[model samples]
Target: MRLSTILRGGIVVACTAFASGTALAEDLAFTLKNATGVAVTEFYLSPSNVNNWEENLLGNDTLSAGDSIQVTVADGRATCVYDIKTVFKDGSNVDDRAINLCELGSYTVHE
Candidate 1:
C-alpha cells in the first residue's frame, strides 16, 4: 500500500509539471496593425536578448496603412519580451524593443 501511494504521488507531480511546462511553451496569437502612413514591407520579431533579428514574419505580404495582420509569437520557450522591427516600402525602418508580448493581444505601429 505504501508503494502504491508513492507511485501515485510521483505520477501526480509529473503530471503537474508537464501541464505547467505546456502552458509556458504555448504560443500566444496577436495582431499587429500598421498605423504608419506607409506600407510595411518587412516585419521581424525577435527575443529581447538576441542581437540578430529573426526572419521576416510576413512572407510575401505587405501591411499597408491601417492594415492589421495576425501573428503568432513563439520562440519554443518561456519568453515574454520581444523586439519588433518594421521596414517600410520606402526603405525606412524602425525598431521597438522590450515589448511584453505575452500581455499584449494587439500592437500598432505608427509614424
Candidate 2:
C-alpha cells in the first residue's frame, strides 16, 4: 500500500510541475507595426488594470511609416490583457485597452 501511495504521489508532483512549466513557457511576444501615414514617435504598453503607464518601449528610436518592431511582453506582474498606447509624429495619440498579449501575434497602427 505504501509503495502504491508513493507512486501516485510522484505522478501528482510530476503533473503539477509540468503544468507550471508550461504556463511559464507560454511567454507573450508579438510585433508592432506602424501602418499609419506618419512616423510613430512613442510606444507604451501596460497592464490593462493599471493606471500608471510604463516607459516607452521604443526608447530613442522611432518607427517610421510602414515599419515594424518586435515586442516581447515580459512584465513580471503583468496579466494577459494589456493596454497599448501609440503617439505619432504629429502629436496625435491612441490608447487601446484590453488587448490580450498572449493571443496577439501582431498589431498594426493606422491613421
Candidate 3:
C-alpha cells in the first residue's frame, strides 16, 4: 500500500495509509494550526473516550496565529475521534475542537 500525503499550506503535514504493498502499523500525525485570532500559549490533545477526563497528551507551547504543531500516533489502531483544545498562559480559553484520526481518510496514524 503506497502511502499518500496531504499538503496543508505548503507543509507535507502527514502521510496516509499503512505502507506500500502491504498492511503495517498505522500512525497519525496530529497537526494543529493556530488559525484562531488569539495566540495560544498552551494546548492539549486527548482521546474522546476513556473516563479519566480530558487527558493532556501535549502542551506548554506558545503558538501564534498561523503557527502549527504535529504529533504522531501509533499504528494498527482503529479510527478514533479526538478532542483538542487551546489554552492561554493567563488561563484564558481559546477553543475546543474534535477530529477523527487513524481511520482511512481521517488523520493517518502509523505505528
The numbered model that scores best in TM-score is 1
True lDDT of residue 1, candidate 3: 12
What does the lDDT come to for candidate 1?
0.71
TM-score per model over all chains: 0.75, 0.72, 0.50
User: Is 2 or 3 the stronger prediction by lDDT?
Assistant: 2
Cα TM-score of candidate 3: 0.50
Comparing candidate 1 with candidate 3, which one achieves the higher lDDT?
1
Models ranked on TM-score: 1, 2, 3
Which scores better on TM-score, 1 or 2?
A: 1
Which digits, one per residue and each the tens of the lDDT, describe model 3 over residues 1-111?
111222121122234333444444445665555565556664554566633324333343465555555555553444466665667545676433356654423332111
Q: What does the lDDT read for residue 24 in candidate 1?
A: 35
| lDDT, ranked from best to worst | 1, 2, 3
lDDT of 2: 0.69
What is the alpha-carbon lDDT for the whole of candidate 3? 0.47
Candidates' C-alpha lDDT: 0.71, 0.69, 0.47
Worst 10 residues of 1 by lDDT: 1-10
Comparing 1 with 3 on TM-score, the higher-scoring candidate is 1
> On a 0 to 100 scale, what is the lDDT of residue 30 in model 3?
54
lDDT of 1 by residue, 1-111 (tens): 001100000112347658777443566567788887899888888779989987887766678787776676554556778898999989999989999877877878986
